[model samples]
Target: MLRTTIMGLCLAAALASPAAAHFQELLPSADVLPEGGTVDLDLVFTHPMDRGPHMQMEKPLRFGMLREGQTTDLLPKLVETVNGGKTAWRTSIDLKEPGTAIFFVEPKPYWEPAEGKYIIHYTKVVVDSFSTGEGWDEMVGLPVEIRPLTRPSGLWTGNLFTGVVTKGGQPVPYAEVEIEFVNDGSVTAPNDAFITQVLKADANGTFSYAMPRAGWWGFAALTEAETTMKSPEGKDVPVEAGALIWVKATDMGKAP
Candidate 1:
């Protein structure tokens, strides 16, 4: 019983907190078009502020992108209300002209976390930008083959999910693989209702799963060392199953 309780706490701790910023910055979808010029937006983060003898950290303020997503960090724009008074911090951009406009915005710290080194809620945006990712195949120095495998027979909830985890052109053995849902943070601890499934790589950096559920999914993972760094501290750390690689499984014949 003691062991089970400890394990349960560990699992809860891991999922209880979020690690680093989801994506370093508000990544832009693609290279800025010639027509795209310097863009500017707002930045805001929420926190538990005490107003009366009784305090509540419930409401969330609408936010806008304040800077571009880049390796460099920038100043943040924080709007605060104290004693029924409102205060704000705003910043601007000068993509100046078009042509080769590489807009890089730094993420500013809006608010400090009440307990941890970071704000309980870490949020940011890029004015009019969106971003996605494509990893490098370092092994042989090429892009790897990342194909969704054919569905396994006699299964409905999940299909055969096979993908290559390569680096510098070769398979990354022992690399962890995972699938998770894209969280639309409407409320805190939103995924608490759903059970997330996980998988690991083999000596060949291959992974398989019986599918955590019959629904949309995203795939993500990192090298063992990298994964360790991202794991949160205090209580049991939560495992980070990366972005879901959306998949659909129409049936589950009889998951054996």
Candidate 2:
């Protein structure tokens, strides 16, 4: 009887533990469009480090692009798609001029039963068209955002990406930031702890991480919202607001 009781306690403990981190991915087909053309983007919410167990993302609250100080609504162009057997979104935009295009999405609040909270991630990605090299650091004016200090596009492997965490245009001191790489089944983690890399921003709300691999990396600055949301059970739960940015790193190699 004692052994069975102990087994029950262990199972409860495991269920109570925190689940893997969920990252909202806004991945573009190419970070740099040498010649102006249409670039496709994939919007998926999942544990990018594990590359599975995707969460269904409802239609976003807002989706748009910023180019040359003008914001264009792209929500009408979003097409429903499936990823990892879950609902996702996809859209494409044509760059007609040489400049930087910042695509951003504000997803609907997702209710997590385990955590007992609603999650809303404001995610964005930068695509440089014709290498304009300007407007890479522009802000999308999200409630919580990461203003990139380093150029967001055309990065080489091992480049240190830096950004400042902000809420309502003001810096968030010592914010918690989570980093994860988009796994393509080429690398494996030794343990669960190695799956998600975490760090804290300094007093100025600035943090940096060097990309170790040549692939897409996502940085999420997580914080609580000022208000709560009603969960499906009709209970008011806290809101977890995440400001995420995706960047691509390329390895130095000769072109074929």
Candidate 3:
């Protein structure tokens, strides 16, 4: 008899427990990816402070935007963190043009001269919101993503290497993999064009980087390369290509 009562109480307690909740995160979007490669995006979302995600909490979250690359060397150029959700931490960018995007989309418009991806890292929360039993749902969100559909900068039949150095077929662990935009037929090579930071490979032997502009660029296992240089005595001397290597650039594009 005691066991039966105890079991009934346990069942009631289990039924009384609050259900697990889920919060829908909001993403900002770009209105346009300028043809000349300059565009501004709007960060808009409805945030109900007294709800599931915000939780009446003032603890700041981080928000920032980096870059994403497309297929073509010069594919059309286009446009991170958790909370403060603050402005001093954010800024805009100017891409050269021919950016591409590869967000999750149909036919996977990959390498097709056009593609799609959502603009990331903009920090703007809409003021008004309507509530429900669980929490308030956002009505409007900045929805933007694009695609240039260009070939991946670094293509391989298998995986690529990154971070450390390898020679004579030595398996260099921790080598970094990276891509650099170069003057191909895509863009005229803007004066502002510079090398992005080195991207390291993961344990899966994968290294990837995002591009912010559209143009012909190259991908290479970053390493010290020997180049022929003219010596002061007019003799050939070996020079290093720094910590860079490259692949061919292709036509890239970003969606509006």
Candidate 4:
């Protein structure tokens, strides 16, 4: 009876633990390009805080870049690759003019058996070339997106990042937002709570977070889609549509 009681207690504790948050990463080689050059992008789906056990990412439904109020198709440029022993993608873009390149991806709906739902995260990142910083606030017309109230680029550590959670060009009031920093094997979390920071948007659909470390930070505003999708087992399930935006923070130090 004691053994069974101990086993039951362990099971209960495990069920109450928080799971690591999943983030779709759209990272660029450089957030700011002083001189025009090619910028390489890494597309991966994984838990940024844990930094391992990457989930396989299939070919995205759409991949494009928005600059100067124009969208350019980049799906054909994606090259399949492996990251963390899982399927991922890589692509590069050449920028010669002064503009803000907003790269975005609409990944195919991923089925999460553990969550019993389909996950689709519309991920994007801003890369400024020649430091023009123009059109940094332009929207890419994603199904779900985070409209940045604060400048997404040219940010220093400890800067407060603010954005509005929008779905179909409208604000989503009191949405839930998850924040995670891309762990570079430097800092360790004390416990599961430190793995992913969670917060709710205000009534205006706006949320903010101050980045403390110097690295890539991803903000994911999650919500349920109005439509449901058929699971692999022929059962309809809810969809977890996420609007994710990535920003880079640099330390205040002299340039080499």
Candidate 2: where are CA atoms >4 Å away?
1-10, 16-18, 254-256
Number of clashes recorded per candidate:
27, 0, 65, 0
Error of 4 at 102 (Å): 0.3
Off by over 4 Å in 4: 1-14, 254-256
Where does candidate 2 have its weakest 10-residue lDDT segment?
A: 247-256
Ranked by lDDT, the better of candidates 1 and 3 is 1
What TM-score would candidate 2 get against the native?
A: 0.95
TM-score per candidate: 0.33, 0.95, 0.23, 0.95
List model 3 lDDT by residue over 1-256, tens digit each: 9999999999898767532111112221332233434333222211211122222111123232222322222111122222334221122345453333211101100111111111112122111111111111111111211111223332232223222233322433455543444322344323322322345544533454544444322333433323444444565544322122222222233332
RMSD, candidate 2, Å: 2.0
Cα error of candidate 3 at position 188, Å:
11
RMSD of 1: 13.2
The candidate 3 region of ten consecutive residues with least summed lDDT is 105-114
TM-score of 1: 0.33
Candidate 4 local distance difference test against the native: 0.94
lDDT tens readout by residue for model 1, 163-242: 66655446677766544433333324335333234467779877765554443334444432222222144432222222
Tens-place lDDT digits, model 4, residues 31-114: 999887899999999999899779999999999999998899999999999999999999989998989999999999999987
lDDT of 1: 0.35
